[model samples]
Structures are given as C-alpha cells and as structure tokens.
Target: MFRAKPTFVLLLITFIFGLIPWIKAHNSSLSFCNRTCASKHGSGGLTLPYPFGFSDGCEIKLNCSATGKATVGEFPIQFVNGDGIRVNIQRKCNRSLKTVAQLFGPNYAPTANNAILLNNCTEAAFPCEIPSILVQTHFSSVSCSDSNSTISCYSERNKRAFIDLERLKKERKCEYLLSSISAESLNTSEAPVSLAVEVVELGWWLEGQCRCDVNANCRELVSPHGRKAYRCNCTEGFEGDGYKAGSGCRKAFSKCNPAGYISGKCGGTTRIVMLVGGIVVAASLTISLGLIMCCISRRCLKWKMRRLTKRHLSEATGNLNIPIYSFKDVEKATNGFSDKYRLGTGAYGTVYAGKLNCDEWLAIKRIRYRDADSIEQVVNEIKLISTVSHPNLVRLLGCSIDYGEQILVYEFMPNGTLCQHLHRERGDGLSWLIRLTVAAETAQAIAYLHSAIKPPIYHRDIKSSNILLDQNFRSKVADFGLSRLGMVETSHISTAPQGTPGYLDPQYHQNFHLSDKSDVYSFGVVLVEIITGLKAVDFSRPQNEVNLAALATDRIGKGCLDEIIDPLIEPHRDAWTLWSVHRVAELAFRCLAFHRDMRPSMTEVAAELDQTRRSRSWGNSEDNTCTPSSEVCSSSSSSNVSERPLNFHKAELAGRRELLTFGEKSHVNLAQHILRD
Candidate 1:
C-alpha cells in the first residue's frame, strides 16, 4: 500500500516541471501566438483584421464608439477607410507647422506631398509664390518621411533630395511654416498636401518561427536559451501542422485517400495517454477560470451595494416635490459629465446631453463652480421657471443641488442654438422665410411673457444664443437666469443693466431703467441679425461697423439696407419680397429706437410681423421708398450719430419727418441699388 510505481512517479514529476515553463511562455506570448485573430474593430466601425488589431498581431490600436466615432491613441479619428485615415490636427501640433506622425497614431507617417502650409505673419519679407505668407512661402516643392522629423523643401516634384530645413529657418523672414491644411490631398497634385497615414499597412500579418496555416491555433513553448518556440495545431476536427509547417493543416476527412484509405488510428496505450493529458490541462484551466470569475463577482457585488446605499440615502434626505435625482444618477446619465456628452458651454453653465432614459435625452446644465450671482440666479431660475409653462418656452423637467453642484435639467433641443444657424455653422443657411418665421415665433414668445403673464416677465438676455430650436426646427426661448418679473404697477424696473453686449438696450444703459422695451430692443437687434446675417458684436470689422446694431442703423439711415443684407436672400427680388423686407426693416428700425417710450411693445411687434406675413406688402406705403437712412434723419434734424446718448425726443421727431420725406436724395441711389431689375 505504501509503494508508488517508479515509472508513474517519474512521469508525473517530469510532466509538472515541463508544464511550468510552457505555462509561463504561453502566458507571455498569447498576443504573439494569436497574431492573426481579430482583436477589435477600427475607428469608423470597420472590422479590424490581423495587421490592424490592438495587440502584438496588429500594427494599430483603434477604438470606435457606438455612434461611429473612432479614435487612435490620443487623437480623435475623423475617419479610417483601409490604409487611408483622417485625424484632426492633434492638440500639441495644432499650431505647429512642423508636426510629427506619432501625434496621430502609431504606424502613421506624414503624407507631405499633398499638404498646403499657411503662416500667420504680418508681412512677407521675401518674394514668395503665394505672396501673403499663406502657404507657398519658401516653395521649392516639399516632402517628408515617416522616421525623419525635419520637413524639408525639395527642388522638384518626384525628387528625393531635400533642401536643408535649418537653412530655410535662417533664410526666411516670416513666421515658421504654419500648420498643414486640408483633410485630404492628391499625391499627383503640383503642390504638396500635408496628410498623415500609416507608413506600412500590412506589416503584422507574418508570423515568426511557426508557419501557421489559415485558421490554425498556435501556442508558445519556453526553451532553455530564454527563447520562445511556437507550435501550431489544426483546430479540432482537423489534421496536420500540430507542431511545424512540414505538413500544412487539412480537414480530417480530406487526409484520407479513397484508393488506399486508412483512418489514422492510435493504439490503446497511446489513446489513454492523450486522454489523460487533455483532461489534466482542461481541469487546470477550468479551475483557474472559476477563481477569476469569483474575484470579478465580489467586485461587482461591492459596487452594487455602494450604488444601492447611495440610492437609499438620496431618497431619505431629498425632500423635493419636483423630481430630484441623486448625484450618482446625474453622473451615470451624463457619463460623469464627460466632454463627449457636452452640448455647449456659456457664462452661466455647461449644458451636457444626458440620457435620463434610453429613449429620450435631457439637456443637463451643470454649474460646477458657481459664484454668488450664479447661485442666486439658479435659485431664481428654479422658482420662476417652475411656475411657467409655454410651448415656446423650454420646460424645466428637474434639478439637482447635490455635492455643491447646481444642475438644471431641461427638455433636450435636438437642433442647436439659433446662433449656430445664423452663423451658418449648420451646413446650410436658413431661408428668408425661415428667418422671418423665426423672428415672428420668437416675437410671439416674448409677447406672451410680457402681455399674457399676470406679472410680465422681462427676458433681459434675448440673444440668438438663448433661442434653442427643436427637432422640427421650431424655436423656443431658454436660459431664464437673467429674467426679471415685472410689476404691473411700475413703468420700469430700477436695476443695473444686464444683457448681452451687442443686444443690450442703449436707453437702459443710459438711464439704468429696465423696461419691457429693453427686451424689445434686444429683439430688434436679433431682427437686424436675421436681416443682415452678421454678428451683433464682431471686432473683425472696420471701426464704424464694429457693432452690428450701430452698423445696421448706419446702413439703414444711408438708404443702403440692400448692401448689408445676406447674399443668401438676394435672389428673392419680387415686389412682395421687397415690400415685406422693407416693412420688416421699418419695424426693426422702430424697435431699435433710442427711447423706451418710442420703441414698439413686443405685442405690437408680434402683431405687425404676423400682419406683414399675411400682406406680403405687394404695394403699400410708398414712403418706405425713401433712402431709408436713419443717418439722413440725424443730419436733416440737426442730430448727430457722434452725439453720445442721443436726444430720443428730438431723434424720434426727426425719424418721423425722415420717413415722411423718404428717399428724396438717396432714394434714387437706393432704388438703383435695391430695386434693380
């Protein structure tokens, strides 16, 4: 009973010792061994095979989100189709004219022959081809390499010899070559386009030592020389290539010859040995997998418990009538307020697109670092917004004040802000009809706040940015943190002037009296924005035209409103279109009047817009034909634009007289310019 068989004891010891090194090598070379097996899909949702996978078998590591957004290393990939890939200029090399391939991703090399380089220099010091320091600076035709960091100018197309990069730096007098432009470029083009691509796409498909056939499984063996040996085996139900490439893999059935077929059968002793070896390996692997799974379960349970505790605490302490969510709930919905979920940011807060449910999204405005004004505004927003409900107004769904964070949740507007549309950032420009409709709808909403409410609400911040559009392109006014409730008895609210710079009321600024007319003035500015399709406050303009309100007022006064109108709307030159446009101009002109008393109410403005839409102004009010210049009114009535704080009473009287006179002098010029057939 005590005696162990000598042969069995030796066999067991040998197997155990041999298994240790095999296991270590196998673990270390899992990636190398399974080199051709697909690990992941590339960015842009292309299934990455072999050379493009994430481990030792692949040349590139790529990840793609469900939305088809892809990324390579630290750079967000614009696209990836076969060997060609597009990545945005990486953050580090965004301003750098000389960029490296590493910033885009591994295996990427510069496509230097197709890039157009531009520089930010005040003046050109040398005789350049482009002459503006915008590309073509020291143009001798250029090219680059995957390993070489210095970008040099070459003498001719298809030439390998490069001009010394250091020599050009000392010779040129402008800012060093600006960053490469364009997402794509042709290699055959006369000039170079700077693009980055994988230096070689199919470098990882070859295997080392082991010549594995297609669909073959390979493993590693540890050797005494501290080297690894690869062993290939035909997948189950197959034969050959179990160790090396001396015989390639074949189907078990195909291995037989029909004439002299003999099934490769083993003796009883050999079968028993093979069975015992397989059982030992399988049992060991199963035990190891079970241990791993158990450890994972413990972590999952701990996380689940913590989540349950948080939910329990949120319910017990949060005494809110409005739907209140836990900090964790908000975090999970927005993926911890990730930048990927962000919709836009403003002075008040950053709005993130959060999934409260799988079907719908909520615009979660998070004010993480709130100052005193913002905190007070959040409180005011909650109180005021809760009481209001209008189709044109954004609905307040819920809020969270957990962990010192002020978060307001709103019905997500799929379409972005009106500003994005007005600026033509949404691919196409809004049609004239759509612009007019937006103006009318926005006016109606403001009119509702001013006239329909018991105590009228003054929307102090009535800029295009605050106007959000829905899926159907229907507009709604949002961001009520700057709103003030008007007292029915008081003519004006005595407060410090607060509104967007370009849209702020001039009268309010002069007198510090915020009235319903202040909102009207801002809306008037928006109307001008719609009409001109220009920024209300753009510093990238001449001094006189820096402020769009002032510029529009100047242009309208000079009887040259046609000159300032957006080119997109220029095709509509019908009589009705002209008359409607003229009427709209007059309305905008009146709304932007210097005095609050002089400005029309939002109700009157809304009514007038609707009426104009109906009439289309085929032929009415010839007085509008006058030069339409507010500047002319200033001159005739002895008023001056140079006059700081215009005399509203005098200017108002002059405006009336100017309208009555209408285009006596400049009208002829305007008729020629505006009503050209």
Candidate 2:
C-alpha cells in the first residue's frame, strides 16, 4: 500500500486490480472524488469542492497537484448561483480551493432528531468536520457543550478544516482540534465567512442569489475568514471594485458633464440666467416708480401754485368798488365765487381780476355798505351806468348782490387809471403822445356822454382821477360815483349838488337846479389842470396859487400861458403847438363863463376842441371866447355858466336867442365870492 505515493498509487491500483469488482468499486469511488464527491449536493444548492463535493460531476475551481493537493489562488472561493455565498473551507488553509458554501450550511444545521446539528459531527458538544462524511442536519437541532449532549470529544487542530474523523481518531488527537459555533453564524443573511464580505454576497445569503456581475468585481472576491463572511460580486450591468468601494451592487448609469437635457428643458445655467433677469426687471420697475413719483410731486407743486393764484384773485374781487366781474360768469369761472380764489384789495371792497366765461379778464369792484341810503345811491348809480354804453366809457361787465354786499364788474383796463399816469409817477416813461391821447380820449368820452346818450349823461366827477386807460392808452370815463342822467329838455337830475370838490358846479350849488352847463364848468377846471399839470385845488401848493383854474386865468391874461403849461411839454417846442394850446386855453376860459347862456354847450365845446386839434388854429367860435369868469362856476354846466359883473344877458341873447332860461336866477355876486380865487 505504501509502495508509491498517491499519483503512482492510483495508477498501480487501477492496473493491478483492474478485474476485481470490489477493488474497482473503491478505486472508481476514489476517481469520483477527483472529479466530484457525494451524490447529494451541499447546502445552498452547491456541490462541495474536490474531496468535498456532494454530486458526481462537480469539481473544485482550483488546481490539483500530483499529490492530489489543491493549489492556492488570490480569491479562490465563491458561492454558486442561488447559494448563500461563502468560502468552502477555513479561509487561511484553503486559500487555493475556490469553492463556496451556503450561509445556513451543515456546520450549524439542525440534526435529524433535534433542532441543532453539525457537519461530520460525532459528539453533540464538539462538532468536527470529516472529509469522508456528509451532513444533512437542520441548523437548529443541536446545542454544543451542554448536559444531555453526546460525547465531549473536542479537538482544535480539526476545528476549521475538513478533518477526516477516522484519521484524528486513529492518531488519538483531541483537544487542539476542537471547534464551536460562531455567534455571527446565527445571522441568516450573512454567510459563514468573515464580516468583511461584499454586501452583494450578504444579499445573496439573504435572498439566495448573487446580486453583482463578473467584470464589476475587479477580480477581487470579498469573502474572508470566519462566520458571516461572504464572496464579493458586482451588481449586474455594472463594473467596479465593489468590495473596495463598499458599493457591492452599483447599477450601470449614464454619465454626463457639460451636457444638455435630452428633452430641451431648462438647464442649471438657463435657470440661473432667468433668475437674474427677473431680478433685474424687478429693480428697474422699482426705480421707474420712484422717478414717476418725483415727477408727480413737481407737477403737484405747480398745481398748488396755480391754486394759490386763483385764491388771491377771488379775495380781491370780492371787495371791489366797481362791478368789475359779472356775477354769473365770474362765479362760473371761479367755481361759484369760492373763497379759495381771491385777488387783491383797495379803497373799495376786495378787487378781483376775474376771468369771465368767455375767457376775458375783468376788474370786479365789490363795495361794502350797511346803510340803506348808501345802498340806494349805489343801486341808482348802477342803473344810470347800465343805461349807457360808449367806447370811451368804462364798460360795466355785470353786478353781484350777495350777502348785503354790492359788486360792480367792468372790463379790465390793462393800462390802469389816468391818476396813475399823471400823479403816481409809474416807472414806465409816459410819452407826450400817450398823454395827449389820454386827454383827447377823455374829452371825447365826456363829449359823447353829453351829446350822444338819450337825454344826455353828465359825468360830474371829470378829473384825471376818474379816467382809466386801456392797454392801447385809449382813455375811458370810469368811476361814475357822482354821475347823473335825465331828459336834456327838462331840468337835470333833481338831487342835491353831488360832485368832487374843486370840480362841483357853483351855479348848481347855489340854486338847487342841475343843468348840462354844470358839466362844462367842471370840464373847464379839468382842462386848466391838464394844461398846467397842476391839481384843481391843491392845498399843498402855495395858498395864493392853490387853485389851478384861477392861476391859469391870471397867467393867460398876462400872456404867460407858456409859463403855466406842463414842463414835460418842452420837447414839443414849436410856436404852432404853443399857439394851439393858447387857443385851447382861451376856450377853457369861455367854457368857465359866469353867464350860463354864454357858456358853450359840450357839443359846441367838443366840436371846437376837435377842430382846433385838427387844424391847430386859434379861430374863435361865437360861444368859445376867452372871457374870464367873474364868479364861481358849476361843474355840471355844459350849456351856460353863471357870470358875475358882465351883463352879457341881453348881450348873450343878442348873439344867442336863449339867454336867461330856467335855473338862471342865481345871485351872481354870491357865486363870485365862492369861486375860490
């Protein structure tokens, strides 16, 4: 039996006993161990390795040397498909035997008659592996090293390897070859290998299959030594070192970098751009809103200024002396006479520069009066003014009656009043043409009042102070506070003599009878004042020369009209101009005649002055002669002035038929005393 070793022994035994059936049977069984092992498979459906298989055709995935010993490999052990993956033998000793076992293998399987058992087990307390034996025991049938257990034959050298039990028993080896159940062997999901096994193998132990593919394992099996160890395997359809990375079953997936979405949906870059764009749009809108607010604020400020202007205009218009603004039109223009739109003030009530419904401006005179007498006078004056209309007249716009206050509206005269031009010394240089235009215009207006209007109107207060100039310097007769109108054929308006001082008719004052000649007397004084550039009765001047009319008469008789004319007239230094002025001066003297019949009518006087202005002549009309008056004159006279000493009565009748008429019996001597010499 020991003539040769195992390589030669198998050949010699096969040849020498080739015809012996029992010997051939044993040899054939030995041959079968070379290829396969026992017919029944190992646990986990895998046939054991050579000298350790459970089927006729299974062979270990390891090289056998001539001595029938397994060769070593890097990671030689691996579980079959559907087997709880684990190494086949003690990991260190069988490094070459590339076989694997189930997680619930024969070592800890239950025995036939109980709940725990072992493979090649002889004693219940100490299980041992035997190369010649197969185990079909349940994992829960046996308990080791306890009472009621089988023989306690423990040996350490045979603990992990397949230790042929007949050899150990014959060699009488005991304590060093013993083995015990590992604590991790009870974990059903882990194989009987080390805890360092791949998760795929552990997964297989739990699910009975490999979860990884071949190329993914990187030629590195993860199974190590001891219980709970399992073989490494990469996941199907993937490739990597599953055990090293601990990603045992990574599935194959596409890799992309700097690539777009296949469906053209928004990418990361596009999303970022969209977000930034949205932010920019939002910021721009915010800035635009702020700018709009600033513009709106400026616009609001301008509107406020306009509103303030309207308010001031309204306040002034409310207290004007004249009816400068129409009630309906002004109220409609300024939103119902609202207090929010006042203008200015003066001696009258508030004066307003009002815009009419027709877009024309007007000066509104609002006058205040509590007494019934004053109110009656204002109403009467308004009625008289309403009855007349002339270009030279200050046109009445309308009137307002509200809250016991009277308002007269008139067309706006942009050039202001003649008083401002004459006495106020406004900054604008007044040319002689403009001044003469004012005088000529005033004369024409007064003449029109005395001649044109039916029954004739007499402007009792005919002073530079009562004249207003338009933007074109056209003079207008304004402020008819003392005007009167009645039938010319009859006596004048039956009222107390009412007129400004120095301009009042002396004849009308002594005898309470009004006549057209009263207006002529006033015109004479105005003419003297205009030529001399002096006030009618200026108390501020030297008392001897205080009365402008008397001073002019004295100077004229002495051939001193040159010394009395306005100094501002020196620019027009022609003798013809001086002669024309002297002629007008003489006519003014005649108009102031003390004899009522001798005084020229406004028609005669206006016609003579017009002709004199046109011709620049000194021709004498019968009614117009420089006859110095001997007595005071009534400014209301436009026909005849009462004379003192000169008995021109039959003499005046010698030239004119109507000499001593109605209102002609006044005492001339008394009139002379009051004429302010």
Candidate 3:
C-alpha cells in the first residue's frame, strides 16, 4: 500500500463515514418501497389490492371491519378484477338519484363499460338500449308510472371510462336510477342471473401526478370530468404497484445484470466515476427542487389572496344590519344543493333542508329564476316579509343574495305541508278534529295578513300546498312570492291574475283585480279539500267535476253533501261531528261564491272557524244548545237576506237534520255510495 498524507487521509475518512449513513438510508427507502401490500380478503371473499386499502395512505380508502369485511360507504364490494371493481347495488323502488351520484370519488367512478338505466325521465326522447317492458320485468323493484317516461340507457365505448353523473342528470333530465350493469355482460337475448342485485363496474385510478418508481412507467389519461389523470405500471421484468409511495417495482428474475456490482464486472476506477456522476445529478436535483418550491409558494399565496378578496367582496355586497349569510356557507349547508336535502320544488324555486354552521336547522329556498324581474321579486319578498312577524307565518331567518344567487332561509318545519298530509301518502290520516284545527289556524294566518298589517298584504296564492305545518301540526303560511301590499284607499289592486289554476278566484281571473278576497276564494278550495279529501284540480275525475270547488258547489247546493264528503271522516259521525261538518261546509260554500263581494272577509272567516272549533261537543249525544258565535249565527240566519241566494233549500235544511239523527248509519251508506261511484 502507498503511504498517504495525514491531513488528506483524515478528510477522506470523514467523507467515508458520512457516505455510509447516506447509502444505508437510500437502500432502506428502496427496500421499504419494494415491500408488497399484505393481501387481505374483504366482504364477499373479495381480495383488496394496492390502491384499495383500509389505511389513510391508500389511494382509495375503504371501510374495513375487524372481521376483514370491506365497504365503500354503504355499498359492499362484490369483487375486484384488474383496474375495475364490481359493487352489488341493492334494488330499491324509491332510491334517490343522489345516492348514485355519491358513489363517485377522486380515484374511482362508475365506468363507461356500464349500461345505466334511468327511470322517470321528464322527456321521452332519450335513446333506449333495452325495451321498457324488459326493464319493467327484470328490474321489477323500480316504479315508473309515467307513460311518457322513455326508460333510457346510457353507455359509451371510450377511453374516458367513468360516468359523469351531473352531466347525465342535466342532459337527460332523469332523476331516478333503476339499475346498472357491465356492458360486456348485457345481452338482449337472455336475462341476467340476478335481478335483485345489480353489479356496477367502477374503474379506479391513482389520483394526481404519477409517483412511479425508477423502473416503472406512467400513463396519462383524462377523467370523466375532463381532468388530467394517470396510472402506473411496472416495466418489463418487474412487478408490483409501481408507485414509490406504495409497493414499488421489484425484479421478477433472481439473476443480476452484468452492469451490477453483484456480477463482479466493475473496477475501482468505475466506482469513482459513478460516485462523481451521482454527486452532480444530486446537486442538479436539489437546485431544481428549490426553484419549484419557490414558484409553488408564490402561486399558493396568490390563490389564498384571490379567495379572500372574493369572499370580502361578497360580504360587502350583502344586506347590512340583517342576518345576511354567505353563498358559500349556504351552499355547504345544503351539500351543494344535493337532491337528498330537497324538500320540494315549486314554480319559482326549490326548497332544501340545511343544517348551518351554528348548529341550526333551516329551510332554504333557492330562487330558480335569474332574470331582472325575478331579482326584483326576491327583493320585494325580503322587504315585505321582514316588516311583519306572526307565530303562524313562516319566519325569514336570513338571506343570501350573492354570487348571482337569491336564496332565503326560513325556520324549518318538520311535518312538511298541509297538501302532503291531505293528498299524498304521508303518515296516519288527519283526524276530523285536526283538520278543523288546521283550517282554523290557516284562516287566522290569512286574517293576520289581510287585517293586522298596515297597507294589508293580499296573498294572491293561498293553495293548500303553500300552507306549511310545524312539528306540532300548527299551520304556517308560506310562499309570499305572489303576495302584494294592498292600497288602503282602493278596494283592490289591479294586476294580472297569478295563482294556481283550481284555486284562482274566477272574478279575479276575469277582471285582473287582486284583493284579499282572492285569498279567501283560494282558502275555500282548501277547506273543500279538507272536508272531501279531493285535489283542487284532478282531470281524471268526471269532466264536469274536474274543479274541486265546482264539484263541492254542485254537491252542497243540491243537498247531497253525503256524496262528496271524505270517507275517512265517516267513522267520526257523532251528533256534534255531523253538525260541525255541515257548518264548515256551509261556510266554504259562501266563500266560493262567484262574486268576490259575496265571500266573507278573512277576519269573519277566522272568527267563525275559531268559534266552531271551540263549540265542539265530544259526546255522542245531541247538544242542540251548542252553537257558533253570535256573529256567525247571525250571518247564517240572515243569509236569505243577501242578494245572492245561499243555495241551501228546504231539502238541504232537512238533510242537516237527517245527518244529525242517522249519524253513523248515514255515513256508512255514503261510504258505500262513494265506493260504488
């Protein structure tokens, strides 16, 4: 060996010591990256691989139980094959389209390989890959009663292998998913093995820039939403996830190449040359990384400031000295207006149930129109409703009128609307007493609007659907979009008639004169709906009886009230019940008069209804002494004095007595007659 200088030898030894740890750390990282993911069996004996794991570091995290069962959200994994996973979707008749939309994620989505069946579409023009009869037979769980529904199929053979749910909903107008299946398995000639379980194939990929090992390859692709995406694969003679952060590429063969140190083909000079080249490459990488980090930091700052500026601008534009919420806050509360939170849709807007950041639940109405006229209407509603306050009125909690959105927040009602209880299959039927109470409370709310407020507000649209009910089943008047402030000097405001078809006041419809009496006429329709359990407008009924108000007018005027009364209330046919029902029916007849002047003012209507409810006798025995208030009794007695005859003749008067005496027996006959008709 040659003798070396003491100082040079000392420096060499120190450098060698430093290199030892660096080499060890580099080797350790490579070994860790090369280690494979421990294979595990999930639910339905499905094996979970690299990208799908139970830990946070996984590209697609799945919920795993202690027993090795795995699930993505509420859906269980049926099988895992290559880049696709099949999840078994349970058949449901009323499953929301939002549920299927929720299945999409950053790393995985329903692939274009699936043939999706959409039901209850708004239009019948969508292309159908399978016949509607076949869908009805195989997917028997779904119910699409609309004859115009197209029962469309959506599938595409393309590289963008995931379903764009939002696009599908927007373009097709389909709100319900009947079923989905892999295109490869679909055949018009034969039925699938299982009708109850639909297998949807979802393609998954690692999201973000490729983090492949040195020996792996990266392939770029476009996501369903047109965003850049990528996938990694091990090069020839290697295997594993190919990601540096996952199970990196590993050699498949046991023998090493001739270029490697293990083959004993390299000398000391070669080792020195390799070390110098490695140093230069490492220096270059360090410089490039620092420059990239600087650029990223500047970009991040710009983005943060831009968001802050936009939020500040929104806040400044909002209403001051009021509970003005941010659009982003409202959007987050309603989950970006997801259909799952939607309560109902109307001509003007859709209502969604939202839970705010303050731990308060609210009903948010998102105005559908964005025209200048619609914006003015939104502002008018805010101004008019903010001035009034009542227990029976839907309280406006706040509003958000930013980012081209006009949204109003109100106190949430748990029991939905009066229309739902009276028409749709909601829950146990409303008792006769409850209906009476609802009618009374609703009348009081309308009275408050007509009389209590200065420049009295005329609710031009007062259908049963606009009346919301609270947890206690108390009525609250809602939807002030068509409401207008009356001119105290004038009898009525001149405007185009704008209201629901069946409930619209005929006088107003012809004259274009809007007044408080218009609401009274609408309320009369609601009252008739309460007594008869009939919709305001049903074209399916006999042509002459299409309008419920017209039908009630005919039946009540002809002394045949038994023919139209709801069979549901027939069981409550005590003497008091008979008398009360007749009184309310007579009041409804007066309200539905063709002439607006003939209808009772909301004040008189509220007082009479309140008195009728208070005077009810629970006992089965007849109580001739039980009577309405003096005002209502006087109105009833003096009805013959009015210009328009009260429609009730001697036969109708005698019919009332028969109703009181026959009670349950008469109602039984009426129910049988109704069923026969």
Ordered list by TM-score, greatest first: 3, 1, 2
Give per-candidate clash totals: 14, 95, 0
Lowest-sum lDDT 10-residue window in model 3: 668-677
How displaced is residue 30 in candidate 1, in Å?
71
Root-mean-square deviation of every model? 18.3, 55.4, 21.2
Among all candidates shown, the one with the greatest lDDT: 3
Whichever of 2 and 3 has more lDDT, that candidate is: 3
lDDT of 2 at 524: 83
Query: Could you tell me the lDDT of residue 618 within candidate 3?
Result: 26
lDDT score of model 3? 0.70
481-510 per-residue lDDT for model 2 (tens digits): 666664642654344456665676666655
lDDT string for model 3 (167-261, tens) is 67776667677666565433333333222226688877766677788989998867766777777788999988787876788889644343553
